[model samples]
Target: MKLANLSIAAILAASSFAIAQDAAPVDTDGDGMMSPEEVMAAFPDVNEDVFTAADTDGDGMLSMEEFAAAQEDGLIPAEEM
Candidate 1:
């Protein structure tokens, strides 16, 4: 049972890491920063506030961690918005 639990935990950790890697920070403008306008342009239907909310770090670019954290925070849902 102990081994099985460890294996499960390892698998979960690896999966999480893969997802985190795959959900890379988008460079929408090719200018090295993920600006609010870029995000808005990508999902025009989504409110401008969504991009602002996602950029939690206030670095002017929504890093992968920041975006994922935003989703976890309910600021931006899993959907396009």
Candidate 2:
């Protein structure tokens, strides 16, 4: 049982690490907002349409709140960071 528990824990850890590594932080500048370019850099699958939709304020940038809202709206993949 101990060995099995250890194995499961190891597997979970590896899975988490892999997921974390696959998702790049969009705000590379640490400015608390993400520009379209920055979003693209972090998530290659993100395009102009996605960025525009995520920029709820139409300010050409996504604040942390906007980004979270976008994720909730399925405009941005939550796992994509």
Candidate 3:
């Protein structure tokens, strides 16, 4: 039972990691960042204002880190992305 539990835990951990990786918004242009256009394409319902605000760097683009932060701050919904 202990071994089975450990195995299940490992599987869950791996799955979670994979999901997190897959959850990153596609960069589309391979620029290491996501433009508002790219984000809109992936999440049409996202508010432009919210997205602009989440762009903490004012770069007019969002890195994966920024995207995650937005999700955490409720500016973006995880399931919707």
lDDT of each: 0.63, 0.77, 0.77
lDDT digits (tens) for residues 1-81 of candidate 2? 999999999998886555434333777776767899988877778899999988878999987767767777988777753
Itemize residue pairs with steric clashes in candidate 3.
none
User: TM-scores of all models?
Assistant: 0.50, 0.66, 0.65
For model 3, the stretches where C-alpha displacement exceeds 4 angstroms are 1-20, 23-25
Mind giving the per-residue lDDT tens digits that candidate 1 earns over 1-81?
A: 999999999998886676455443344545445566655655565466777778877777776667667667876555453
- Model 1 error, position 51 (Å): 1.9
Strongest candidate by TM-score: 2
Q: Mark the regions of model 1 whose C-alpha exceeds 4 Å error after superposition.
A: 1-16, 20-33
User: How far in Å is the alpha carbon of 1 misplaced in model 2?
Assistant: 50
34 Cα displacement, candidate 1 (Å): 3.6
